[model samples]
Target: MRRRHLIAGLALASSLTALSALAAEQGKPTPTTKEILAKSAPAEWRRPDPQNLLVMQLPTGRVVIELAQDFTPLHAANIRTLVRQHYFDGLAIIRVQDNFVTQWGDPNDDENGDKDKIRSLGKASKTLTPEFSRAIAAKQPWTPLPDGDVYAPEVGFSGGFPVGRDPASGQEWVAHCYGTVGVARDVAPDSGSGSSLYAVIGQARKLDHNLAVAGRVLEGMPLLSGLPRGPEPMGFYADPARRTRIESVRLAADMPAPERPAIEVLRTDSASFAALIDASRHGHNAFYPEPVGKVGLCSLSVPVRDAKPVH
Candidate 1:
C-alpha cells in the first residue's frame, strides 16, 4: 500500500510541474512594437523647438518639417528668410518623379516653363556654399545603427535625421530617405539657395552626397509623395495647370504661441527607442516564421506626435 501511494504522489507532482511549465510558455510571448511603445516612459519624447518647426500648407493638407539647424545652419537661415517673405505661398509642386522625388518651386524656372518669368529671390541669396556634408566631430550627437550599410562605414541618427558617417574621413551627411527635403540646385554645386526643394518619395541612395539635405517632412508626406507623377521628362510638368498649389509656408515660431503646432518626437537615445529597435531585430510571431533580425538606417521612421491643439 505504501509503495502504491509513493507512485501516485510522484505522478501528481510531475503533472503539476508540466502544467506550470505550460503556463510559463503561454505567458512568455514576445512583445510587439505597439506594446513596447505603449509601455514607454513620458520623458522618452521631446517637443521640437518652435524655431525649428515649419508649417506648410497645400490645397490637400499641411506639411510639418523640422529644420536641421545644427547640420545646415546656413540653409535653415536662408529657408527661414524665404518663409518670412512668403516666397512659397503662391508657388506650386512642379514635378513628381514616380518612385523618386516631388519638387516644388516657382513654376517658371524649369525647362518647360519660361525662365524670363523667374520669380525674384527677394531677401534670400541666389546661391550659397554647398553644405552637402559636414565633418563628424565628437560634439555631434550620434545614435549609431548596428547593422552594416552599403554606402558608408557607419550609419546612425543625428538630431532626428538619418545620417551616414565615415570615421576615417570624419564626414557625416544625412541619408537620402523617403520624406527627406533636399535643396534643388542649378548645374553648379553651390547654386542651391533653398528657393526650390525636393522631397524624396522613393529610393534615391544615389543622390546622397550630390545634394544638400536641408530637412525632413514630419507630416503630410503622403500628400506630397502620393501625388500623380508628371508626364514630362525628368518629372517636369508640361502644363502649369496640373501642378499642386502651395497655399502658404509659415514658421511655427512666427505664429501666435497658442497656434503653434504642438509636436513631440521620440528621442533616439531613449529606452523606448532601444526597445523599438530590438523588437524590430528579434521579434517574431505566428505571422512571421522568420525574423529579419537586422535593421537598416532608413528602415526606422522617427516617431512624432501631436501634443495638443489650440481649439
Candidate 2:
C-alpha cells in the first residue's frame, strides 16, 4: 500500500511540472514600451545640420524645414542668402490655393507687379536658371525600394531623403508632395527666380515639369495645409489684408544653438529599420484585426522624435 501511494504521489508531481511548462510555453510575454521602442528604432538615426535648417514663422506657428543640399545646392544657397538679409520677415502669405499650395512673399509676382515691395532682394538675384532635374548615376548613391513605382523606374531614399529616379533618362528631381516648396514660374522654364516661391499643401502634383523645387517643409505641414484656401483663382488672395503674416525666416545656423528645436530622424538603412517596416506592415498585437501586407513609399513615415526629455 505504501509503495502504491508513493508512485501516485510522484505521478501527480510530474503532471503539475508538465502543466507549468505548458503554461509557460502558451503565455505571450508582454514587451515593455522601452523594449519596443529600442527594438523598433535604428542606431543610425541622424539630426539635421543647423546650417541646412529653414525656420519660417507663420501667424499660426513656426514651420521648420530642412533643405536638400545634395539635390539643389544652388537654390538652397540662394535661399540661405535671402534669409541672411532678413528678406522674408514681415512678408505675407499672399496665395493659399484650394487643394494646391500656400505661397508667400511679394503678392505682386509679375515683373511689372511690384510697386513698393517691402521684401526686396538686397543682393540676391531676382531670377535663377531652371534646375528642374539632375542626372542620377551610380556615383549618386541611393537605396532603391523593393516595391515598383508608378512615376519612375526606380524609387528610393537617397542621402537620407525620399526620391525617385529614371534610369533611362538618368535624371531625378524633388517630388511634388504636400509641403514641397518650389519657385513659381511662368511658361518659360528659366523664368522662375528664387524670389516668387510656393509651397505645396495638398496632394502630390506629379505633373510639374521643369520647375525648380528648392526645399520641403519637414515638420509643420499643418501650418500651411490647414490654412483657409484663397477665394480667387489660382488661390491668390485678391485682398492683401487677408494674408497671413510672416514674422521672420531664419536659417538654423543663424539662430543661437540653444534656441534650436532638438529633433532626430530615423535612418532608412539599418536592421532596426527592417524590423520597423516589418512590424508596421504586420502588427503582432491583439488589437490589429488583419496584418497589412505592404506600405507605400510616402506612407512609411520617417518619425521625427524629440531627443531630449520634454517637461
Candidate 3:
C-alpha cells in the first residue's frame, strides 16, 4: 500500500513538471491590470445612472458616489431626499479614524454640539428600516469570486459593489470594502436615516450586515482617505475647527447635462473583469516571479475611466 501511494505521487509530480515546461515554452506572460483594462470592450463599462449618482463638493475637490439602490432602496431613497433638500450641504467631515473610516455629517449631531443647532431631516425619514441585508434576488447580477471568504459562505460583486452571501439563508449584503459608504446610526439598528455617512478607508469586514450601505466612492477616494486623524476616541474631531466643511452635496440628476460628471465604471459581470480576477490570482511578471495564487474580496478595485467624447 505504501509503494502504491509513492508511485501515485511520483506520477502526479511528473505531470506537473511537464505542464510547467509546456507553459515556459509558450512564453505567454501574464497580463498586467493595465493591459487587461486597455483591452476591455466599450460594452464592458457602464455609466452610473444620474439619479443614483451623488456629487459632493468639498473645499478640495469633488467626490462622486454611486448609490446601490438595488441593495438598499430605502436608504438610497432617503439619501436622495436629503440631497434634494440640501441637507448635507455645509455639513462637516467630523471624523477621520486612522486605518478605519472617514465620517461626515452634521457636526451638531455629535455629542458636544448644540442640540438646538441640529439640522432638520426635511422630508427624509428620521429613522429607516435597517437595510443591513436582503434576500438575494434571482435576477440580480452576481459575478461570484472563486476565492473563499472568512465572513460569509460566498463573496462576489453585485452591480459593481462588493458583497457577501449566505445561500442557506438566501441573503446578501454589501461588504465594507474600502471606499464603501455606509449610513451612520446610533445604538438602535433603525436609527440610521442616511443623513450621516462614512466611507471605509481600511479593512472593515466586521461591519458587514451591521450597517446599511448606501453606496461607494467612484472617484475622489483620496479626498476622503487622505485626511488628518481626529484626536477623540473613534476619531471624532475634538475641536470644531478640525472638521472639514462640506461645500455642497448635489445629486447628478439635479445638475445640467454639461455640468454632470462624465465617468464610466467597468461592469463587474464582464469577461474583462473575470480575466482581471484570474490575473490577480495567477499573474506573474519580472517583478513578481510567482503568482500570489489568492485574492481577497477587497484587494481589487473596479476600474473607472473618464468617458470619451463622441463625434
Candidate 4:
C-alpha cells in the first residue's frame, strides 16, 4: 500500500510540471509584472543625445521634444538656429484648434503682401524653401511595420523615427500624428520656413499634405494634449494674450551637462523588444479579459525609461 501511494504522488508532481510548461509555451509569465520586465530588459537601451533634445517651457509645464534629424534635416538645423538666437524666447502659442493642432509664432505676417508691423525677424528668415519630403532610398535604416499604411505604399520606423514611403515614387514623409511638429505656412505649402510652427495634439490629420513635417514631441506630449480648445478655426486663439509663451527652446547639449534629462530608449531590433510586442498584443495578465490579435504601429507606445548613473 505504501508503494502505491508513492507512485500516485509522483504522477501528480509530473502533471504539475507539464501544466507549468504549457503555461510558459503559451507565453504567459508566472512572475509578477515587475519581475517580468526585470528579466526581459537587455543592457543596450540607448541614451539620447542632449544636443538633440528640445525643451519648451509651457505655462502648464515643460514639454521635451526630440528632433528627428533623420527625416527633416534642414528643418532640424533651422530650428537649432532659431533656438540659439533666442527667437522663440517670448513667443506665445497663438492658436489652439480643438481636434487639430496648437500653433505658435508671429501671426502678424501679411500673407496678401500687406505691411507687417508686429515684429521683425532678427536673424531668422521670414521665408524658407519647403522641406516637404525626401527620397526613401537614401540608405536610411528603417524598421518596416507589419501592418500596411493607408497614406503611403509603405510605413515603418527608420533610425528610431516614424516614416511613410511610396515605393513607386521613391518618396517618403514623416507621418503627422499626436506630438507631430510641423512648419506653419500661409496658403502656399512651399512657403513654410520653420519659423512659425505647430504641433499635432489630436488625431492623425492625414488630410494635411504638401506640408513640412519637422519633428515630434517624444517625451512631453501631455503638455500639449491637455490644453483647452481654441475658439477660432484650425485652433488659432483670437486673443494674443491667450497664446502660450515659449520661454526658450534649447538643445540639451548647449545647456550644462548636469541640467539635461537622463533618458534611455529601447532598441527596436533587440530580441526583448520582439517579446514586448508579443506580450502587449495578447495580454495574458490577470486584468485582461480578451487577448487582442493584432496592433497598429502607431498604437504601440515606444518604451522609454529614466536613466540613472550606474555605480
Using TM-score, give the best candidate's number: 3
Top lDDT prediction, candidate number: 3
Off by over 4 Å in 2: 1-42, 110-114, 137-141, 279-292, 309-311
lDDT of 1: 0.81
Model 3 regions lying over 4 Å from their true place: 1-27
Model 4, 1-311: lDDT tens digits are 87865553322111112223357447564333233345545474777777677787776777777777766777777778887877777777777777678777765653422255555556666666666778775676566666576677777666555677788888887777667788887777556767777788766647334777767776777777677776666666666666677777778878887777777766665544555545444434333345443545555545567787756
Question: TM-score, each model?
Answer: 0.88, 0.79, 0.91, 0.80
Ranking by TM-score: 3, 1, 4, 2
CA lDDT scores, all candidates in order: 0.81, 0.67, 0.87, 0.65
Of 1 and 2, the candidate ranking higher by lDDT: 1
Please write out the lDDT profile of model 3 over residues 30-128, one tens digit for every residue. 445666678789999999999999999999999999999999999999999999999999999999999999999999887799889999998999999
User: Would you list the clashing residue pairs of candidate 4?
Assistant: 50-253, 51-253, 93-244, 95-236, 95-237, 96-235, 97-235
lDDT of 2: 0.67
- Quote model 1's TM-score: 0.88
